[model samples]
Target: MSWITQKLPDVLFIQEGPGIRKYEYEENGYPMINVRCVQDGYIDMSSARCASMELATTKWKHFQVDEGDILYTISGTIGRSAIVKEADLPLLMNTSVVRFKSLTPDLDPKFVYYYFKTDLFIDELLGHSTGTAIKNVGPSHLKKMDISYPSLEEQKRIVAILDQAFTHIDKARALTEQNLRNVRELFESYLQQVFSLIGDRYVEEALDDACELITCGVAATPKYVDESEGVPFLSAQNVKSGKVVLDKYRHISKDLHAKLTKKNMPKKGDILYSRVGAGFGEAAVVEHEFEFSVYVSLTLIQPIEAKLDSYYLKYLLNSPQIKSLARSSITSSGVPNLNVKSVRKFLITYPALQKQKSVVRSIELMESEIGNLESIYQNKLLELDTLKKSLLQKAFSGELTKNMGEAAA
Candidate 1:
């Protein structure tokens, strides 16, 4: 606390959002930046709304956004901030954001923006924010926040060092993201090739012929009485492509589960296929022993023990070909949906049981390799992010400038 008082003593001018209405925006007028515009140290003006220049000036003159001013988000998603650029000029702040202009000329706006991105600043802001459902921190709270103050030249040097470091870091991240995409596309392409390669010995059979049971999940959903106190309930969101996501799961009472289970109780080896909504056609085999109920949007498939392998069927259902077919089979409706009958009609080109095992083995190897690589990439990304935060901390603590001077000498 003494460190903050000693370092930061200048006045800070903070302005809340204009709280403009939808009717105030115009097709051909001045730009209006919202919380979405401020991200990753830059203001993206492409999606900003245009408002009547005359009306904005008359009503929201105080909220006028200028180049070099810091655009900060104060509500909904707090702590995200960006420095306003020349391209983002001639704009106004919406209700969800606030503008901060440093009254102290010694402080660099970019330095202040970078400081706001630090963990200390964010934690402080979050601590002061008040709300039960949605947290919010007003200008009064922001004004009380403290920050390190250095010489103007020292601040600029630190900013330059950070700017250079981040440029390289961002470039590496972009390449990693592209590589991840390429790896996924390669896997999908190989998947299609594997399925397409069928010999004369292979036979075409309806999906229903290979499955002992194909049925929809529970029709009635239990209300969210208490999230932590009930049995796990699976939905379309919980069922991913080739995987079952258990996080963010809803719950139902024991009585409701008993009632819902009357339709069907999910068991180990049962394939949970998404029949409606996003991720339609994706499937995952339930490999756990825990009891859980699923929503109606997911179709439960129990493959014949002798006729089909559950793991093989899971990969097949998640393939691009089957996903496309499922989308095409949907009845002309407002939302995409696949019924049990249509799903049953999907053709399955199956090989002998032994050959099926060989194919599954091959695909599993590729999936495992991809999963490992993804884990490495994700860890590296996290490391890079951590390094960035560490650099920010050092820059504000005066160690960054001190180290740079020693290296130069």
Candidate 2:
């Protein structure tokens, strides 16, 4: 009962603007921050902007969010929070926005920041949210908010523990992220080394001499009755993020698949590259067993696995140089297209089958290590996030005090 009203310091609602909902704006409306600017877990100033600067002096002057302010989205994308990094820039507070600033020296700002990130606070915020489609929360709701923390020393201790813990976790995660990037760069570099073009210094060999075959799919608008009756129409859309996203996979009738060119069904090992639309030339190997009903806008590039490795070649096609060259060859303005003929012109070095296998083996090894590091840190971060949530729950509910002496020490 006593904890319910601990007489904690005041936490104000984000500063509200003078303008009401659906209000008409003048030439320079209030310069409120955009919702999109406050991205998940961070503030993206890249797209952050003010509504307009013109407002009455009394309203306009106080709207500016200062440095060291903690901002949270009180409207759209509820619970999205981040600390304002750029203190110099004067950004008008957006609607349903709130800030927590001017903390006493006894309180730790980092503790305050972490405290706001807990499920307890989120539940408290969510409990107050009103409206079905779009939850609207304003100043009155924030002033009534409550949170509990230990004494100043405990607060500093909690922040210190979190700081050391997150620092270690973050360093590991950062290294893994960097390693993945390095592997990608290494693969790209290998591609360039294979296909060097200079002032008539490098040899330009025909792609056919290097690759086994380049096959094009059929132009068929396959019919779709039901997922129970038809096979999935594997289009370029399925080739997303370097893998097939089967959730939105389309289906085509059996009759349509029969009428469509036999080449429409790509066999395993064939590299499928999107040949039409905005995502042209993005390729992925057909690794899974699926009925492929492809469009003519797509092409299949394959190499005799004995003579050339498809993964290595797929890496080559995705390289920046090759992609730029392919983009330049597109003729249609409305829908950019790259045919099999144009793809045959793609230059690459044919470093004997043995060396090709060696390159593949080396990349595979590095990729495996990078994958492990990424998975490890990814799992660790998830655990830390969950721990943060659990700790926040305990801290607010009084359970956090059991270990308070040890943690504080």
**TM-scores for all candidates?**
0.86, 0.64
Error of 2 at 186 (Å): 4.3
lDDT of 1 at 303: 89
Question: Model 1's lDDT to the true fold?
Answer: 0.80
Return the TM-score for candidate 2, rounded to 2 decimals. Answer: 0.64
Task: Tell me the whole-model lDDT of each prediction, alpha carbons only.
Answer: 0.80, 0.65
Off by more than 4 A, model 1:
1-10, 20-31, 45-55, 132-134, 205-209, 219-221, 225-229, 275-280, 326-345, 402-409
Q: 297-328 in candidate 1: lDDT tens per residue? A: 89999888887888888888877788788988
Model 2: lDDT to the true structure: 0.65
Worst 10 residues of 1 by lDDT: 1-10
Q: List the residue pairs that clash in candidate 1.
A: none
Off by over 4 Å in 2: 5-11, 14-32, 39-42, 55-63, 74-78, 85-88, 95-112, 123-172, 183-226, 234-263, 274-282, 294-309, 319-345, 351-366, 380-394, 397-409
Per-residue accuracy of model 2 over 1-409 as CA lDDT, tens digit each: 2232332236333465445344434445544566666664567666544454445335467767776777777786677777776743566666666777744565566777777777777778778899987987876776677767666777776666655555655566577567656756665675566445323333347666665668666675655678898866666776764455566666777887776645435667778888888998787777877675676767777776766677766655776777887898787888888877888877765566666566667656755765676676567667656665666565555565535524532
